[model samples]
Target chain A: MTENPNVPVLCATGVSAIVAGDAGDFRVLDGVSLEVDAGEIVDITGSSGCGKTTLLRALARLLPGAVGTLSLRGVSAHDLTPQAWRAAVALLPQKPTMVAGTVRENLLLPWTLKVRAQQSAPEDAVLRAALDGLHLSDVSLERDTDRLSVGQQARIALLRILMTNPSVLMLDEPDANLDDASAAQVTQATSQFASAGGAVIRVRHQRTDALASRRFSMCGGQLTETTS
Target chain B: MSGAGGVIVIGWWQLALATGLMVLTGALSVALKLGVAKQLAIATARTYAQLLLLGLVLGWIFGLDSPWAVLGVLVIMTGVAALTIARRAPDAPAGTTGISFLAMLLVGTFITFVVTGLIVRVEPWYLPRYVIPIAGMVLGNSMNGIALALERTFSDMDARSGEILALTALGATPWEAAAPSIRRAMRAAMIPGINTLSAAGIVFIPGMMAGQLLAGADPMAAAPYQIVVMVMVATADITGSTLAVMLTYRRRFGADDIYLERGYRPDSRS
Candidate 1:
C-alpha cells in the first residue's frame, strides 16, 4: 500500500471486535467494512450497544481486540506507526475530558504531545477564531476548563482534536451534551472540516443528519448502508 | 547466650517474660472482642520461631565468611523480598513479581557494594558479617519502596483513565501518557524514606542504631554507621522505585500502544 490522493482517505475491511463483558467475551463488531473519501461526511446511527462506537474504535486502533484491515490514503495501517496512525485518524470519545488547565492550555494539548512536538503551536488569534467559530466567543482563553459547563467543555474538546489537523475525524456523539444552537455549530464545524478535504465519521443516536453524504445503520454488530 | 562485642544477651527466662506480654495482649484483645487473639498468638509464635531460626542461620553463615555464601544468602533475601512486594500490591499486574525481583536485586546489590566497598571500606568486602546484614537491609528497604511505587502507578493510571486516553488518542506514547502518573507514584514511594530521614534521631532511634547500641558498640561509631545506613537506604529506595516504575508503566498500554481501557490485570501479564 502507498499514499495516493485518489485513494479513499480512510478504508477498513472485515473489521471485527470482541469486548469482554461481565457474562463473557462477546463480539461487539462483526466483519464490518467501510470506505471514506476526502471531503465527505459519513454518519453511523445505531441503538446503544449495537457497535457504532466499536467500529470507530477499531478504525482508530484504540481497541487491541479489534482485528482486520485498516488503512489511510491507501497505506495499510501496519505501514504507519500507531502514533502516526492515530495522529492522522483521531477518535473523540463520548465523554469529553479536560486536563487540569486553562482553556488555552486545553486547546493546545495536542501540540504538547510528543508526536506533534516538531510542529509549532497555533497562535492565540487562531485559537480565538476557532473558539469564536464554535460560539465560545464570550469565554476567555485564560478561564480554567473546570469552570466551564459540560457543553462548553465538549466544544473545547472537539476544537482540541481539530487543532491536530487529522485527516479523518471519528466523533462519538460530539453534540450529545450541547444545546441546539451549540449542536448546530458543531455540525457546521464538521461540515467546514469536510469541505477542507478531510473525511468525517460520526455516531449519532438521532435521525440521519442532512450534512452526511452517506448514512449507515448498525444492528446486532452488523452495518448496512441506508438510503437517505 | 552472649553475642559478640559485649552484647547483653537475653536469657530463655527473660524471653519467657516477653512471651507473657504477648499473652496479656491476647487477653486484652479477647476482652475487647477485637477478634485478633488467635492471630496475635500465631504471629507471636511465628515471631519467636522466625527470629530464632534467623539467629541460628546468621551464626553459621557469619562463621563461613565465604563470598559465595554471602552472595547466595543476599540473592535469596532479595528473592523473598521481591515476592513479598508483589504480593503486597493487590492491583499490580502479573509479571510484577519478576520485575520487583529484578529491581530489588540490582539496586540492592549495587548499593550494598558501594556502601561496603567504598564507604565502610570493609577489607575483602565479602565478609558475611558485614555484607549479608547490609544487603538484607538494602533489599528490605528497596522492596517496600518498589511495592508502594508499583501500587501507586497502577492505581493512578487506572484512576486517570480519561486523561490517559485523551493523550493516547492525541498520539502520545505510552511513556508520555504515563509520565504524570509515574511522577506521582515515585513521589508517593519516596515519601516514607524521606520521612524516616527527617525523623531519624529526633522522633526515635532507628532499628540499626538501636541494634548497635544493644550490641554495645560505641555511641560515636554507631552514630556514623546509622547515618550511612539511613542515606544508603534512601538512595536504594529512590533508585529501585524509579527502575520498577520505568519497567512497569508501559504494561498499562498494549500492543500498538493502545491504552488498555480495562487497565492491567494480573492474569494478562504480557
Candidate 2:
C-alpha cells in the first residue's frame, strides 16, 4: 500500500485472475502483491504461461475480470477512467503491430485517442526529443514505418509509450525482438526513464543488462522477491 | 390505359407451367443424383405456404381500418426479421439477438415510415398494404446487411483484440480503439446496398421495378420509384449496421475500460 504518496507510483495487492474455460474455469494468478516506485526498475522473470503476462495485464488495468486491489499514482484504479488509468500505467506487449503509416503517424497514434482529444498533439520538438532520447535522432517522421527493421519497430514502439510519459511502464519481453545494439539503446532509454522518476516494471526473457534494482520470479501465478 | 386497369392476369394454366418446370427440374435433379431435389421441393412448398398465409393475413388487415393492426403486423415482421438476421450470423449470437432486433426495428421502421408517410404519401399512413409491403422490403434487405455487419464486427474485433488493447493502453476510448473494425463492419454491410445502387438499372431491373412494370406502371415512373426504394434500403442498411456496431463495440471493453477475457468468440482469445 502507498504509505506515502511520494513513494510508490503503482501498487497491487492480492491480485488474482480466474479465466473461464469451456471444460471449467482455471485460476491464473493468486494473491500476488507488488509495488513499483518512481526511479526504480523491477525485473520479473518466469516461464511462458506462468502468469507473468497476466500479472502485467492486471497491473495495466487491461484484464477486467482480474480481482485485485490495484492503484496507480496512489489513486484507486476504480477511481480513474480506464483510459486515464491505462495511460498512467502503460503496458507494452511483446509483439506490437504497426499501423499503416509513416513513422511520424505511428509515433503520434496515441495522441489521436479520444482520451487525448482534449489535449493538443505533441509539438514536433517533443516528438524529436522522444526520438533523440531513444538514440533514434537520425530517424525522420517522413520515413515509412514498413521500411523499418524489426529492431527499429521495437524502438518505435518503446518511443511511442515514452512519448505518453506514463508514470509506470510495464514492458513484457520488450527485448525479445531487439538486436544487441537495439537492446542496448532500449536499456539506456529505460534507465533514463527510471532516473527521471518514472517507474519501470519489466518481464525479461534473458537477464541481460536491464539495470533492474530488484528481481522477482513468477511461478504458478505467485510472485516471490529474490535477493540474487 | 384502358386495359391497363386489369392488365393481363396469369391464369391457373400459365402458373401451372412454372410448377411443371419446377417438377421437371426436381426430376432432373433426382435422376442426376444431385441430392438437392428434396430440398428444392421442401423449400418451394414452404415458400408457397408462407406466401399464401401472408396474403390471407394482409387481406384481413387491409379490410380493417385500424392502424393498430397494421402497426402490430409491422412490429411482428420486424421482430421476425431481426431474429432471422441474428440467426444468420456465422457465430452463436444469442447475446446479439436483442441488439440486432433493436437495430432492425429502429432502422426498418424509420426508413419505411419515411417512404410510406412522406414520399409515397399514402392516405392512411399506417394502411396495411402500404406499410406492410414497404416494411417487408426494407426489413428483408437490411436484415442481410446487418447479419453480415454483426458477424464481421464480432469476428474482426475479436481478432483485433490485441490492437484494441494497445489503443486502450494508449488512452483510446472503446470507440476510438474499435473504430477500424466498426468501419469495416459498416462498409461490409453497406457494400451490397451500394452495389445495388450502382448496379440497379445497368445490371438488371430490381424487384420493385419489375413489380411496378408488371402492375402496368409506366417505365419512367417505375424507374423513379426504384431509385427511391434503393435509397431507402441503403439508408436502412447503413443505419442498422452503424447502430449495431456502436452498441456492440462497448461490450468488448468493460465498465472500467479493461479488455474482457472472453468476447463474442467461442474459442478464447487468450
Listing candidates in order, what is each one's chain A TM-score?
Answer: 0.96, 0.92
Lowest summed-lDDT stretch of 10 residues in model 2 chain A?
A: A1-10
lDDT of 1 at A97: 92
For model 1 chain B, give the 10-residue run with minimal summed lDDT. Answer: B261-270
The sequence of per-residue lDDT tens digits that candidate 1 reaches over residues A21-110 is 667677888899999999989999988878898788789998876789998998999989999899999999888999889999999988
Best by DockQ: 1
lDDT of 1: 0.89
The DockQ figures for the candidates are 0.63, 0.57
Candidate 2: where is the Cα deviation over 4 Å?
A: A1-5, A21-23, A123-140, B1-4, B23-35, B90-94, B261-270
For candidate 1 chain A, the 10 contiguous residues with the lowest summed lDDT are A17-26
Over A56-171, each residue of candidate 2 has an lDDT whose tens digit, in order, gives 88888777577889887677878888788888889998887677788889888988887777777788888888887777878888889888888888899889988788899989
RMSD of 2: 3.2
- Pairs of residues at least 3 apart in sequence or in different chains that clash in candidate 1: none
* Tens-digit lDDT string for candidate 1 (B208-239): 99999999899899999999999999999999
